[model samples]
Target chain A: MKYYNWGIIGLGEIATSFTNSFQQENSQITAVASRTLSKAVAFANEHDIPKAYGSFEALLADQAIDIVYIAVPNRQHIEHILKALAAGKHVLCEKAITMNSAELTQAMTLAEEKGLILAEAMTIFNMPLYQELRSQIDSNRFGKLKMIQAPFGSYKEPDPSNRFFNPDLAGGALLDIGTYAVSFARWFFTSQPKVIASVMQPFSTGVDEQSATILQNDVQEMATVSLSFQAKMPKQGVVAFEDAYIVINEYPRADEAKIFFNDGTVETIVSGDSTQALNYEITNMIKMIEGETSNRSLFLTKDVIDLLDQMQQNWTN
Target chain B: MKYYNWGIIGLGEIATSFTNSFQQENSQITAVASRTLSKAVAFANEHDIPKAYGSFEALLADQAIDIVYIAVPNRQHIEHILKALAAGKHVLCEKAITMNSAELTQAMTLAEEKGLILAEAMTIFNMPLYQELRSQIDSNRFGKLKMIQAPFGSYKEPDPSNRFFNPDLAGGALLDIGTYAVSFARWFFTSQPKVIASVMQPFSTGVDEQSATILQNDVQEMATVSLSFQAKMPKQGVVAFEDAYIVINEYPRADEAKIFFNDGTVETIVSGDSTQALNYEITNMIKMIEGETSNRSLFLTKDVIDLLDQMQQNWTN
Candidate 1:
């Protein structure tokens, strides 16, 4: 059994969570890096990692690191990803992979040319509960699907200095919580929506604070998604069919789902390792590193990027 | 105490329910009319109404009627309302009162000219719980209002001959369940929205089967509404604020409301006569007829119709 060595770029909060997921696995955080040497050393001590570097490029240069996980600011992902790929490292970047599809396409082309796997760390696709729901939907278990409603939001005070309200960092609801709902809709449909309509309101700091979107396919299947930095929600996704409907709460790391039938009874299905949801993605990343790609089936990073781009265009126009 | 007599223009299912709401009131259904004499006679006999007319004209001509409750098809509302005003009777019409704002303007103008009350029987505005919510919102009980999400939908098999799928009757999800959500948004904002974005998917019968809309006002207050004829929903409305939020289930006839604050304690408020939700509308209609205009506050019948029209236009474009 081959162990996968990992290097993390940008010692952010998400990077710590991703490193923690490797505790019981065939992967280890071999190296970590930050903009300053002291912070990188502190993070390395915190995680008990082998190496610490003062910059992302120094971390990428470590030949023992098979994959580099980028958890930097949203607008900087593409640049860091390209640098990691150039240093012959497989990359697993955080969600909202890049600013737009054009940049994503360029990064994907680089990864393809280098024969390296590039994936977005969207844990929902690795969730067992979401997988089961998709399988049931594909097998006509819920009958004719009609509509889907997904909402993800949180109330954040609009501070001008916070990254969430900073326009220079590409901070907005669509790039944060909105991406999950958009990806869920695309996965459920398994096809690009024919129509995308959206409206966005700006925060006081000039970033898109809240957005609502509607996606419809040729068969009249509809999906409604609402995301905001102005409210906190229960974080549920509802998929409706002719005879029954399914509601999945905490959809991003969904562990349980309920099916409400027209007959007035509800069937609940519980799955997914909630405490270790990130482990699934880590394991899949290892599998891809070993040339076994089956676990990467529903990796819709590019499609989600495209959909968000379309929705933003719709909102702006 | 003088009793008010009602003349129903269309003896359909809604008319039956409206008449049922008068069980404990200062009003009585004196006459009923339908396009066919047998149906009108059967409905009148079934409801214990005194007089049955074969045509709407006959019901409108009855001088014994103090008001004409027009529960006819959407396309016929304006015509019947005008005729009722001409016959000197107060008009209480079912929602989606007219095809467009122009028609509604003509009807309201005629009612004002004749000194008659022309009200749309939108039950949400009359429900005590909804009124309480508006008052709380007005007084900033929930803090600075951020976003509102309201959804109403039900699975209805598309029978082309059914009124729900018929274009001649001006039928669609927008005119049916969407109207309530639109009215709710309008009533909450108290100001017209600056942007209305929407998407609609048509049924096989060429009427809009599902619609999702986002309405945003000048202060960045946003409202999202979804309606469908092909899905079942929980029929809930969420009003989000800076420090707290409230969820209203069965919002049109809401009897229970839950307020969740940031301090992790939830406060639930239960009010309104659920069993007689429709009676509130009847009671208010009676008050409007008896010169008490306070109950008519937030009578945004024209505004809601205009918003729906704008949303439909946005969906088409």
Candidate 2:
């Protein structure tokens, strides 16, 4: 019956939202950090946290902090994760957890060596509705999983220097938004899937602005992940099966899904709250910290990173 | 304008639906032919048709029949088309018009030499709702078109003897139902598109049971078409643009569509009637016969057949 104290670094919009969950039960966000002392002080004051640090190292080095939540840019995740793990803190990094599988494997190895928990703040991995839906599928009513369609498209202004299209920031649609779609697909897959065919359209800065990919596994389960930055598409994730198909629109933190059965019937399933998305991630992370369960979602995160790796390789060649 | 005297060859289920359009103002379905004389007579008597033929050649030789609608299976389309065209009849053949581009090309050349009209009875080509939407795009208020997704999946019982999986019947999801999806994508495209990536899974009878394909044209318009016979997917056709996206559910013969704008506005567009889908085909064919308009949709049908050709080629290699 212990509440976990969290320390957040990289004071961006997402980090600000993460701190907003401090009032949730079983949560204590005690520390905040930024490179600028004034910015860190202002954020800590706004969130009413007890401590603020001018640098990430100072916060990570704090003895009272149990979890270090990294909200740094995609390019900076690996360094922050390694540094936090080295400073004896369990790390919960933002999505696109690492640039590639190699970096993630290195971080996972270090976390295991240090006997600390490591996980991604991917909403799909933590959403409770998906858990209930998965159990429904396991009950043999929905039948076998057959196909998946996960499309994430956002219309960003055509600015080359923005993080979305910038190469120096590890920017592209895949890392910034495609991660959610890929993770959504990987969650339902029985085994690791391989990218069989893919194509990409690059932006003015030579990064993936949009792409379409097809994936298949040993069990013949297929998925299509379509992503775009120059256009807007609904965050609708569909997992189609034998007897029924489930539709989860705005799926990153969706709390409701509609199951459409072949006999012309629909059942509504609701679980958890969309407002408590970050809180759920925190509570789940705390459970992993308590040795109640493991960070099993890392398997899906690793598979998603590998899939992204293959999607971008299509443009290089 | 003359209501062309129509003769139907191959009195199948689809042919029955075609004759049901006799009540339309511009339809004159006068004759029908079947391999069995009894079936032909039965169909003719049921539809109040004046003539019934024991064989396809007899129907083609009847000078009173100016237009012949070929409602045969996919494998038999080319033969019926070439024979009907040689008899100086304008031919309207069922979809998957020919097995491949070569067969269609041969039929097209003979029709041109004989000064006859040849078209495919693809509902997308004749659906009035799509025509209105295309004009909306051309008006530039909707902005530049960006992406399209045309998914059609139908759950047919897994009877290998049925046409959906029988190789002898030219059965497969792609040829049967996938044609509607591919043709839907081709309708709004600016030019011919090439298949960029494709993957297929065959049923037990070695026919394509399901597949996913990506296509891109010279104008950079991209589309994803997913088809499966083992699953039931709404025939939702999405045409995304910079300003708004139009969604046509049951798009094969859709009569209405919803336009979702980036500014959180939904506009419903209703153009044609769903019940008059077959009648629209006959009317459009009559327009082509009168030389008042060209069978311009044939261009889309041709491109769709070519795309399907490339899609199935993935399995052979």
DockQ by candidate, in order: 0.61, 0.67
Candidate 1 residue-wise lDDT at A238: 82
lDDT of 1 by residue, A231-294 (tens): 7866778888877888888888878989988778899999877778877778778777787765
Please, what is the TM-score per model?
A: 0.94, 0.98
lDDT of 2 by residue, B1-317 (tens): 76678899999899988887655576678899999999999999988999999999999999999999999888999999999999999998989899999899899899999989999999888979988988888898677777888888888899999988899999899989988989999998888889988888789999888888888888778888888888877677888887788888899888999998888899999998988888888888888888878879777787888888888776677
List candidate 2 stretches off by more than 4 Å.
Answer: none
Inter-residue clash pairs, candidate 1? none
Q: Which stretches of candidate 1 lie over 4 Å from their true place?
A: A295-299, A315-317, B295-299, B315-317
In lDDT terms, which candidate is top?
2
lDDT of 2 at B167: 98
Cα lDDT of model 2 overall? 0.87
Chain A fold similarity by TM-score, each prediction: 0.95, 0.98
